[model samples]
Target chain A: MGEGMIQDQSDEDLMKAVAKANQSAFRTLVNRHMGRANTIAMRSLPRREDAEEAVQDSFCKIWVNAASFDPDKAKFMTWFVRILTNTCLDKIRSNPPRAGDIDALADVLADDAASYDAQYGQKREGEAIRKAVQTLPDRQRMAVILCYFEEMTNPQAAEVLGINVKALEGLLVRARRDLKGRLGAGEDNDG
Target chain B: MTDDDLKKRLRAWTVPAPDSGLADRIVMNALRHPQKMPWSLRLGKTLETWLLDWNAGAIYKCASLAMIVVIGLSIGYSSPYAGGADTISIVDLAMGGMNEWEGS
Candidate 1:
């Protein structure tokens, strides 16, 4: 199909084309979702190499399992996020992030003391929040990532996690508490 | 910091852009190594690959030996022709000497 023609199709149509080894469809899908995938991976893994590997592995899985996608079960982003999240989680499980690694990453992200970055304080807070998030138990981290960072609704996030909505809410509650305890934040919004 | 402040910071913190070639790289890698269908079959294939080093031939040999031992015992103890000297011995069955019984 022509590039313009392929661009006119929806994600589900693109995925079906991908199942048939349509490289153009696959490229379109990659272009469509790569940024979100990169953000999820970069946030979760916090290291360039691991995050890159996770995203690559996820897209690879998506390519292979395109045919298995049941639209009734999940939208394309949900399914894709689930894969990316699982890949990041696997990376997390295998290579438990060290404290020094987090600090080093924060320093790297901090970058350039001389660059009059007005959001320096905000950036620092972001790093601290990420650090606190890192300290969370794996499931709690996932809950925060999906519900908060990815901005998924409770049911949608739960669907991706393969957990019930109630359980997912429970995770979020506990996660908020954990983050509160660790960061001295989340007071008014503790619910 | 206020809760909203933290939330705003969370929203604002975007990781720097990764390499421009990433999407292309991912697509190429995926095309090169397409996923297999039906997880169960893939799992079975993976298990087969992993367990290939366990010497399955030895297992088959052991199973054959067990069957031979069972047949030997059944035939020796449960012979139907107990009184006839012309009845084939267990040795005849073992050594393919049952042709003599056919002649008789």
Candidate 2:
């Protein structure tokens, strides 16, 4: 392809080509988004294996539905994240985690804080923050995870949760207030 | 601290890295069974390409013409003119009676 033609091929164009069974175009799109999708899935789903499956499912869904994707409704990344998050959430809800699993996660969080602080030399504050986040209400915790850990924008996070942008903002606000209160910060702490 | 600051700190806390090879497995699976194109889309593209083919276009035109000719022949066979002369004789008798009645 000529440089001009290549320049004109946006992600949407590539997706359209993939819909026509263009292998190279499909590969390019998969390679570009796979890491991000995997990250989001892993964060949302309780099990690593389930997360991987969800990511794969999301990619397949994207491929089948590529032609129907409306650029007017959302950016490609946002749309992709929405699919990934929803897939993970569906899997998680279908198979609730075992009691031991929740405990295992709490242990993992503690270990993570220790190791990260050891490597970076920021101990007390990291531990405090982790504890505060862990104490957040389940919905607030999910919102914080999707918004912060998964790096999703507010609108995209809202889409994943099936809520409007304003609702998402309220959730975030309440989450922040709760976290600050749990951390022994007064209401005026603003976090 | 600001909420953003707290968020930054929370992000620093260790979330387990997903199991290794997940990405590779996903990509391989995707490559093995790429999404099946919608049936409608596949059918439409096939029709479009078939219509664009010269031989297909010629065949289509010939079939259309054949259809038109068959319809024309059927219409001709069923036409009023194709009815026997007895029907015309009946009409003429009815017309003659009407004329006589009008004259009287």
Candidate 3:
């Protein structure tokens, strides 16, 4: 099919084509989702390079498992995000964060850490808040990342994490509380 | 922090959009590795290999002949109904001195 035709195809249709080992369809898919995949990876892992590695690893996996995916079970975006999340997590575990990893996460957590599309620079207050967020437990950090940073709906984030909505909610509540405590009383909820 | 502040800061986070060339790179990498076919495709390929891709009409004839031989052997030698429903077995017939060895 023509490029326009491929671009117009639904994610599921492209996925079906991918299952047939269609290289063009796979290219279209990678172009479409790579941005958000990168964003999620940046938030999930400690370094930009690590995030890149994770995204690359994930695309390779998607290629391998394309035929096994069932559209009825989940949306393509959700499934892809789940794979990216798992890949990033594995990369994070395999290479333990350096001693200054918290500093690295804090640096990347800034408002302008990657804001390529716009002039998004992190303010001092926001930096403190993000550092607080980075200090959360892995699951709690993931909860915050998906629900807040990635702007995923609670149910959707829960689905991606392979947890029930209630469990995800509990993690968010705890993460928020932890962030608030770290940020302190009056400034905790500051804008 | 306030939910709005948190969301705003997150929106500002400088996460890189993957390089435009990365997609092409991934496609090339995948091509080099030629992924395994799904089971359904493999099954279809198997049918084509064993049945459709050969000297077409002869495959079915040979398959049919093989089936006939297997069925005939089962009935004549290993079949429980060899003597009859009420009869015991080929072994029983031999032990009772009711039959001689085949080709004797």
Candidate 4:
């Protein structure tokens, strides 16, 4: 199929073509989802390099395991998110974040600072939110990242986390509560 | 903060966009490493995970080892006598095929 034609196919269909080792279909899928995958990885991981590696590894896995994917069980993005999230979690476990490591989110803020000089207050608020997020327990951090940052639904986030919806809700509630307390304290200190 | 406010604040922590070359790099990496895992290996991983979950990993390993030993022994014993004919007669070789060796 032509590149444009391949691009038009759904992710699930593209996966089928990928199962046959069709490079065009695989490339299309990669181009379509790489940014989202990177964002998810960046949120979960502390370092930019690690996040990039995790995204690469996750896509490689998708290519390798395309034949095993069952669209009936879940949408392609859902399956992909499960793989991406697990990859990130495994990376986190092996090399737990160090206190002094430069965070990828900070880099984002710094880049924003240069481009949007007028949004100084927003930049600081963003920094505070990032710090508060990093302080959350791993699962809770992930819950907030997926639901709030990525905008996944409760069921979708729960599926990615391998928990029931109720459990996922509990995580989000506790996570938000913790963030409220931390961010509020930051504000109080600033004032 | 209210839930809506918290959500809004969370959005402020935007991730940096992925680098322009990321897709090309990932595609190139996949091309270079053309081989993905075979289904058998994936199935093995799934089985291993299941076994570990139930804390039966040690038992699974022992069972696998025992099976290997049993299969090896069975194959060794079965192949030697499978033809039902003596390929090498030790007594004949010793006697040099002499039925009556009435030596001096």
Candidate 5:
């Protein structure tokens, strides 16, 4: 059993272990995906405290629902990000911001900068990229976070967003175009 | 910049490390509540498994009983002396007595 376990410790394995109440295996999974999960939450909610809460809530849900995971349908991270994204979206819709709320916008930008600093040691360029990402529409932003930031494939991102792959591709295209526009880069400019 | 380049740069942005206690807190919360598996689901699974086992056992028993019945019926039908020879002795006895009386 030990040999078999050593040979086959995929996310699925860890999840099964989690279902059996294995704390070590659960911790391993959290360590592996927590950073990306946090990023997705932060991108969607654009606030540190809320994002952190969302991540924690999502992980908790995952722990509870580990037995329901279907490996054939989606990878573990894809499933996980879907939960995180939904939690963030629920938070957003529950309290829709007023039109032209500059304070809200500034708070979002400041949160992004602070999160980046917390993660990457104060890179101005990183903050700029995040600010640009913040300009994307919600769905487009989600697609980008899942596709690029989380390193998920288009189909996986689409699954997380409950959209078709073609739609996901379009969202990604528009998101990239928007990012390029806001970052002062032209169609020819290659970062 | 090209879209690919912009995407690449955006991808390069890193997420800062979360709060040091975040994982512990999440794990602790999970341990505390531990999603309750619904009784209905548990009952359904149990019933499904039991039904499968019962169906297989019933099928085997029914097939065995059928084979036994078939073999018993075949043996009974193929026996030549089953119900045919019992009255033959009485008929022979009566015929012999009649023949003797006629001869006397």
Candidate 6:
């Protein structure tokens, strides 16, 4: 198939082709989802290099397990998020963050802020938030990343975490309460 | 911080866009490992589960062994020379293809 046609194919269809060991289809899938995967990893992990490594590992896993994926059980993004999230968690546990890892996450924020001029106070606030986020427990931090940072719906986030909506809501409530204590007052009823 | 305030704060913490060559690197690394076909994966899973199943009674074990033996015999009997004109009996081979054993 032409590149355009392959690009136009649905993720499930592309996954089916990937199951047959089609490199083009795999490339297409990777290009389509790489940014989101990177974003999730960056939000979850402490260092940029670790986040990138986690993302790479996750995509490699997706390729290796493409045959076992069943779309009927879950959507492609949901499954991908699950894999990416777990990969990040495993990376974190295997190599716990060093003392100055907070600087690394702040450095990523600083790099992002560099594009805008004279946003010094904003940059500081961003760094504070980033550090506070990193201090959260693994699951709570994930809940914050998916719901608050990524703006994913509660049900979708719950599905990605393999939990029911009620349990996810509990996580979000606790996350927000903890963040409130760490950074100041905050009440988010949507969670 | 209110809900909107927290959301704004969270949004301020931005992740840099991945480098231009990131996707290429990931694709190259992943392609080094070939994926298994769906059928083969299923077969592997089935065999793994069967091998790991330790709850079978003696009857099941006997039945499995009998089935294997039957399959082996069937494959042996289906060979090209099993009943062909070239077939040779054990006695004939022992006597060097003679009708009876030669006296030594």
Highest-DockQ candidate:
6
Query: Which pairs, if any, clash in model 2?
Result: none
**Model 2's A-chain: what TM-score?**
0.70
Q: Cα RMSD (Å) per model?
A: 10.4, 6.4, 8.0, 13.0, 10.4, 12.4
True contacts kept of each: 0.63, 0.32, 0.47, 0.58, 0.59, 0.73
- What is the TM-score (0 to 1) of chain A in model 4? 0.93
* Candidate 3 vs 5: which has more lDDT: 3
Q: For candidate 6, lDDT tens digit of each residue in A30-137? A: 999999999889888878899999989999998998998999998899899999999998998999888799885566556765867667557866677777788888
Give per-residue CA lDDT, model 2, range A99-133, as digits (tens).
45444555545565565756543444444555566
Error of 5 at A74 (Å): 2.4
Residue runs of model 5 more than 4 Å from their true location after superposition: A1-8, A96-122, A185-191, B38-41, B45-104
Tell me the TM-score of each prediction against the true structure: 0.72, 0.68, 0.74, 0.74, 0.65, 0.73
TM-score of chain B of each: 0.32, 0.45, 0.45, 0.33, 0.35, 0.36
What is the CA-based DockQ of model 1? Answer: 0.35
1 against 4, candidate with superior TM-score: 4
Poorest 10 consecutive residues by lDDT, candidate 6 chain A: A182-191
- Residue B75 of model 1, lDDT score: 84
Ranking by lDDT: 4, 6, 1, 3, 5, 2
lDDT of 1 by residue, A33-77 (tens): 888888888878856899999999999998888878877877998
lDDT tens per residue, model 3, B1-104: 67665467555445456777777776777666657666887888777877766665576779898999999988787656655644456568666574454445
| Winner of 4 and 6 under DockQ | 6
- Show the colliding residue pairs in model 4: none
- For each candidate, the DockQ is 0.35, 0.32, 0.33, 0.35, 0.34, 0.45
Q: Mind giving the per-residue lDDT tens digits that candidate 1 earns over B31-92?
A: 88856677776678667865685565667667888999999888866777544535356566
List runs of model 6 lying over 4 Å from the truth: A105-117, A185-191, B37-41, B44-104
Which pairs in model 3 have colliding backbones? A111-A122, A112-A122, A113-B14, A114-B14, A114-B15, A115-B14
